[model samples]
Target: MAEVRTKSGEPAKTAETKRPKRADALRNIEAIIDAATRMLAVDADASLNDIAKGAGVGRITLYGHFDSRAALLRAVADRAIAQSDRQLATLDLEGDPRAALARLLEASWELTHRYGALVIAASQALSPEQLQRVHDEPAARVRALLERGRAAGAFRDDTPIEWQVTVIQAILHGASTAVYRGEIAAEDAPGLVRDTALAALR
Candidate 1:
């Protein structure tokens, strides 16, 4: 996400007199995003008008915020990814490597399952490169964690990090699909993925 910042490297402050309007705009944006996320999860083809109504905003307001359906969908995807990034950032990255991997997997597993519908829908509607970008940062973090594990002799060193990252992510995505399809119950998914991924790493 682009930060609205000044040359002094601080977040650009809203004027005192305009703060209320700024707050309203932020609230509307959040409302739109929240409403759209729920709507798209239920029906991938949900209309913009429906989203606007759900958000208690008008069509013009929605359009003013997102401009187009594709843009809104991309924002949905980006917001989800950004949220996970923020939550994952709070985890201890310097702890025991295996424990760190478990922490990461559990966090990712839940997110993948929760956002399964949105992820599937967005991938189909958005550009290929945009979808790839959504996956890239998580994959990089996974790669770094695996490297740490390998260094600690907690995971196999022979396997390439790239392949490990790919397979781990593939497994998480597959587990998420299983949850959405009712093949694996949602509550059971994280543990299943955690164990399977640990086996692969070990």
Candidate 2:
């Protein structure tokens, strides 16, 4: 074949040549997200200019990436949910049900605690439908694990799986809320929350 060339008679970019720009773009997006998450968590009323300054970017750059504050908040929520799913995915689903469930509980508790402020801010920005859509992925994973536990005779079968899972979720959420509200110390939270979830489920 003849040598490839652009319409301008210049060589086209190879993958190596295109990589750095793509990497920079990814870094900018991530920076915007990280800054937005931190700022919004501290102040729900934080302005776009404040976020852009925190991200070390201009207003045009922030808008170019996120479009709107609500859009940015949704992105933050999506990220938290995605991270939670990834953490839950790391558990040994085929292992002992209680052990696996405890792993999930511990992982999820740590995640929620770490993102507590952001989660609260996102909850205010997202509607019930939007909230459920973003949250459902992790919940489905938990449901599947619970189902597996029930099938393996680890969980009580007297109550419907739906009820049991709802209670389990409530307990986790309540535990995280307690941690956020100063009802429970941060150092004491993980074990206390894990024990509470184990007792509720088992």
Query: Highest lDDT: which candidate?
Result: 1
What is the alpha-carbon lDDT for the whole of candidate 1? Answer: 0.82
Over 34-92, each residue of candidate 2 has an lDDT whose tens digit, in order, gives: 88878876676789899889999889977876777777888787787778677777777
In model 2, residue pairs whose N, Cα or C atoms come closer than 3 Å (at least 3 residues apart or on different chains), thus clashing, are: none
Q: Candidate 2's error at 110, in angstroms? A: 1.7
Tell me the tens digit of each residue's lDDT in model 1 across 1-202.
1211222254447366556765677788789989989988878889999999999999998887777787788888888877878887787777898888888999888777767688777786668886776788789889889887898899998978899998999999999778767898878888888899989988
Worst 10 residues of 2 by lDDT: 1-10
